[model samples]
Target: MLRALYTFLIVAVLSGIAIWLADNPGELVMHWRGYEIRTSFVVGVGAMALAAFLVLLAYRIVVSFIETPASVSAYLEKRRQQKGFLALSRGMVAVAAGDAQDAKRYAAQAHKLLDAPPLTLLLAAQAAQLEGDEAGATKHFEKMLAAPETEFLGLRGLFIQARRAGDRDAALAYARRAFGLRPQTPWAAQAVFEIEAAEEDWDGALKTLDRVVSAKLIPRDDARRRRAVLLTARAMTAAEAARGQTGEARKPALDEASKLALDAVSLEPRFVPAVALAAALCAETGRIRKGMKLIEDAWSAVPHPDLADVWLDMIEDESGYARAERAKALAARNPENVESHILVARGAIGARDWQAAREALAPHAGPSASELPTQRVCELMAEIEEGEYGDRGAARGWLTRALHAPQDPHWTGNGYRSARWSPINPVTGEFDALEWTAPSGVLAQEEVPAVAGKAEESVAPAEKEEAPEAAVDTVRALEEAGNASEVLAFQPPLPDDPGPDDEGEDDKGEDRREGERKW
Candidate 1:
């Protein structure tokens, strides 16, 4: 509003001045090259204004003529950029939708028009992968690797391809290169760790594990546990290498092994493998007192068969009774432990004390004497019956019970029970995955047998009608269980029946006696 008011006032004043000049009747004169020209003041002003307008018009015409080609070029460039961006968008959509042909088509257009190497290569590689063209994918990945920004992605793609083709060496090479390029990359770090572990490169694996832990790729506790396992393995290997050495040659290796073993035990006191290794190393180095103390501590924490085995190995040459006494002492440390009870039972068996063995395992055997027996408990009972009472039937019954008993604990890993501990799983190459746990509840359940001669028992007539359905289910379960074992009926021989080898055995005996008499 102020600007408009100012403009109105200036225009009114300029008009008044022009009017005054016209009233005064003044003249405008010009002379150029002896050519004199005269006009009224208003005419002169009008002429000047017309000349200025003409000059401006000519200037605009010249500028338009000069910029025509550049303007057209700029418009074309803008159109090209639009097309490139559109192609890029289409290529991304095609990749998402799994349209290999469309993706490849749009990727080529984006490559040409967009002039972006990373996006072009990524799209082309994805399209090739969608079409199962590994060579084409690899070609694009190689191109990506040439650029520093996309090198990590390219390395990862190539690494995956190598692993798919079962080329471990190539995979490892790619993983190492990628890790060197970007140590903080999670995939690169994990790949290096897994490959090093699979190859049994303990030192390299430890370094990779440390890197992974520092990167926070895995939890702190998991890293510590794995480190403990790796250290234990290292110590055990070093100890073995030092076995035949003497003097200074063996001193360093044994000392390092013992230190690593102790560190492992301290990290995880219940880790039976490391405990056993530590005890064995202590005993081998004439540290008998130290070894015994280590075993006792481990037993008190978690009674284990491996610990018992290592303890027994410390004095393997002792008599059965002495061995039994030593195991009893160990078992006393953890009386409530199931494994401790099992160890006590084993010791009693070694000492030929059947009652003691039975008493040791009595609590876990369910309410009945042999009900719900564990595998080891059943085996022990079988041995006891056979050795003490000489009852073949009872022994056979106990052996059958063992087949249906809960599985015994061992060095279990990846659904398998190994006889010994190793740094890696034999099947899956998993590190420190094994634990002293039972194999029960993993596979098919064990089948059970019904009591013999149960058909002679009669049901109560009063309750029969009310419990018919339940009784039927019970009978069905028994029948199914019996069928699982599939006991073969022992048919008696008929009067005319004779085995195929009966005559041969009789003829051989008669001829052998006659030949011996003749000789």
Candidate 2:
């Protein structure tokens, strides 16, 4: 409404002016150089508007002519860039689709068209990798290193190639450079850490792990576990180096080893090896009471053979009876543990207590069809039969049962099973991967046995004149007269066949995929 009012006012004002102009009959006149010009006010205004329009049109035409060449150049450059990017995209897709030839063709076109070193060289390197052209891939990766933006990418590719070629030193160098360039990158950190660990460079690996934990690359629990394993490894290394040394020279190494072991146990109290090591160091330092207490506490929580070894070693010169008593004491601490029963059985064998040994192992005898006895239990039974009864046939029968018994727990990590403990996995080269447990396919095996069930306290008649009756039932199978050979009649079934072997498997290509560059 306001715009209409303004238009109306302007029209009224124009009408008044027109009326005045008409009434006055206004005109403009000019004379110069023997020429005379005359025009009305409205006619002159119309001529001026027409001349302004012509000037604006002429200015636009001149500017357009001047800009034409540059516009054409920009359009052509944009088209070239678009085509280069399209080729690069196609090459990546071809690589993903496993078409080496098409990937190579597109990569060459992209390399020829694109000026970006990282993008174009990356495509070229991937193409060469697909074609198994190591030389070509190496050249492209090397060229990428010349540009700052692609330096890390180049280093990653070189590192992977070195590893693939089985050049450990070269791989280490490349991994170190990559780690130095970007410490927080997971792949770089992992490569550096694993290589350092594999080389037995404990200090370097520990430093790398520290940085990884600080950067929160892994969970806090995992970091703690790794640190504990590293400390334990350092302790073991220090102990190994101090071997054969005597007097003051040995003390320093043992002290440092003890410190590391103690710190490891502090971080992971359930780690049996660390506990055993710490206890041994305590014993060496003449802290017998401390060591004994550590062993007792550890046994109460989790009984292990390592702990039993250290416990028996504390009184190394003790009599067989005394050792058996000590083993019995250890078992008393962790009465429900299967290791406790095994330890008691071992101690009984040492003391030549056939009845005690047989009784200790009888509970774990092959009775439950679903839950198989451990290899340890079967072996212990063999020992009891040979030493106590002097029966070779019975011992042989136990050996057959042992053949089919379930395997005992071992150090398994990253799908790598080892018979001995290591701070890192030899297969995956990962930290803290070696955990003390039974391997896969035995997740449902229970620790407590159904046969031997619970400990039933039996007081020797000598210790007390009046003792309560022990409710434990003795195994009649092995307790029969020497004339009875039927107890040895049964044996476990044989293991499944692994099928035929291929003798040419050794000639196959290495299965290490980590040593390859891929999209």
Candidate number of the best TM-score: 2
List TM-score per model, in order.
0.73, 0.76
Which ranges of candidate 1 are over 4 A from the true structure?
1-71, 213-220, 236-256, 366-371, 410-419, 439-519
lDDT of 1 by residue, 1-519 (tens): 999999999999999997898689789999999999998878898899999999999999999999999999999988988999899899999989999899999989988887778877888888888889999998999988888999988998899988888888899999999999988888888788777877878889899898888878888889888888888888878888888788888877777788899999888887878888999888877787788898999898877787887887787567878877888899899887877878887888888987777788787663545447775677677677657655444454555565556656656677445556777776676777677666556343223212222321344545434332333244335434533431221111111101111222356655654453211
Q: What is the lDDT of residue 501 in candidate 2?
A: 22
How close is each model in CA RMSD to the real structure?
12.9, 15.9
For all candidates in order, the CA lDDT equals 0.75, 0.74
